[model samples]
Target: MKDIFTCDLRTNSKLPLGGKTIVFGGDFRQILPVIPNGSRQEIVNASLCSSYIWSNCKVLTLTKNMRLSVLASNIQETTTFAKWILDIEGKVGSLNDRETTIDIPDDILIVDSTDPIGLLIEFVYPSIVENAKNPIYFQERAILAPKNEVVQEINERLLKLFPGAQQEYLSSDSLSQADFVHDNIDETLYSPDILNGLRPSGMPIHKLVLKVGVPVMLLRNIDQKSGLCNGTRLRVIALGKRVRKAEIISGSNIGNRTFIPRMSLTPSDKRIPFIFQRRQFPLAVCFAMTINKSQGQSLSKVGLFFRQPVFTHGQLYVALSRVKSKDGLKILIFDKDGKLTNKTSNVVFKEVFGNL
Candidate 1:
């Protein structure tokens, strides 16, 4: 970016960002750059504060909780919730021996429930079957989990309750022809079943089941100008053989109806030995979403499902801050011993904020 700016603006290379004013915004307390199978030091080193630009950058902090201010009705309650969120973000709670676990307050914790997942779904989406057709109900609420597998479980459970005929869409997967020809790879090695089983991040899975009126999130940025970007949630209106018609439920373009077509997508993960392509609709069931993917999204009601402890920085905080108020948020922490506990792991990479 600096090289292109310096050449285009006719500025010296030594100048910071080509002597142009560039404002970078985001919280270092949130999740840092994701490095696959990376160590703690490696993940922190990949952050923006560790870059050369940090030496020339002036850090600016925005202390106001704008989301709370806009959505919260009670000023005092909003202020209290904002403070609590900051404490969670800074990891100020009583920690366990590993300094990773923190005790969740009783108000937000879902306790005395034998079926925690069922309770969580009920809390987030009350009367889901009746409200399944209402786009506003889905737009205002969601269940968040730390891992994709857990999210899928919650989504599938919620889908079973949703009232509609289920339609399953299978992706057409194959190894990239160019990669196969260039590398002289054996075609017999990767069968269709093997290709179908691979679930790459940010891409729809091989078998996608959907029902009319169920909410689905976009995996790719199909049309940004139309507000059909990645992470944008839409309600399926009409299912077709070649295309799907959905109504945008979230984002600035709410209620805007659009048609989504099946597009060929390739996995960007370099760890894969050969290039793989999958042709399918870039959508996933959004009854639940991973905490990492829930960033930048605000909801009136949010259910935090903890099948496993958070493994990354700011994940717990990110999930907690999504709701409008404490009353709107519900958390379920599952223990292996079949005992109810409010304690959960809160992973925070403090080194990323050292320079800032």
Candidate 2:
């Protein structure tokens, strides 16, 4: 970026950023750049704070909670909730001897439920069958989990409760021709069945089952100008062999209907040995989404399902801060014995905040 700016502006190459000012905005309290199998030190090293340009960067902090400020009726309650969220972000409260575990308040914790996941779904999406066709009902509500597998489980359970005829779409999977030829790998090594089973991050699943009114999220950014970017939620309107029509349920393009055709998508995960392609609809059932994917989104109602405790920095803070108010958030946590508990792990890499 600096080189391009220097050439375009006819400035000296030694000038910082070609004598042009650039602003970077983000919260270090949220998830950092994901390193597949990296250690604690490696993950921190990959952050922008560790970059050379960071030394020249001036840090600016925004202390206001604008989302809570919008609620004029509940100023005190929202202020309390906002402060609690920041306390969790900075690990400000009492901690366990290891300084990793924190106790959750009882008001928002769902306890003593025989079927926790079912109860959580009902709390977030009440009257699922009746409101399945209502786009507005799904627009401001979502369930968040720490892992993709937990999210898939919640989505499947919710889909079963949804009343409609299910349409199944199977993806066509194969190794990329370039990878196959360049690596000189035999085709039989990775059979179609094997390829179909691999569900890499940021790629849709092999078998996608959908109901007409159920909400789905885009896995790939198809058209940004039309507000069809990754993490955008939509409601399925029509199903076809080649394309699926959906109405945008969230973001700036709400109520805009668009056709999404089956496209080829490849996973960008480096842990995968070779490149493979899957031709399928670039969408996933989003009755629940992973916590990492829920960042930068604010919703009226959010369900935090803890199938397991958070294992990385800021996961707890990101999950808790998604909702607009404390009343809009509900959390369900479990111990190894399957009993509901109010204690959960909060992982924070304090070293990242050293320079700040």
lDDT string for model 1 (1-356, tens) is 43432443475454766677888888887888888888888888988888877887888889788877877688898899889888876743334212366789898888967787788888988898788777788897999999999999988898898987999999999888897779999989999999999988888999999999999999999889999999999999999999999999899999999999999999998778899999999999999999988899989999998888888877887998888777899889977775678988887777676676
lDDT (Cα, tens digit) per residue for candidate 2, span 1-356? 43432433465555467767889888888888899888988999999898877887899989898876765477888888898888886742334212377789999988857777777888999998888777799998999999999999999999999998999999999898997679988888999999999989999999999999989999989999999999999999999999999999888999999999999998998978999999999999999999998888888889998879888888888999888888888999988787889988888887777777
Q: Model 2 lDDT vs. the true structure? A: 0.87
Alpha-carbon runs more than 4 Å astray in model 2: 1-8, 11-13, 91-99
TM-score of the candidate numbered 2? 0.94
For model 1, state the Cα shift of residue 172 in Å: 0.5
What lDDT score belongs to each candidate, Candidate 1 first? 0.86, 0.87
Stretches off by above 4 angstroms in model 1 are 1-14, 91-99
Question: Which residue pairs collide, candidate 2?
Answer: none
- Model 1: residue 49 alpha-carbon error in angstroms: 0.9
Cα RMSD for candidates in order: 2.3, 2.3
Taking all chains together, each candidate's TM-score versus the true structure is 0.93, 0.94
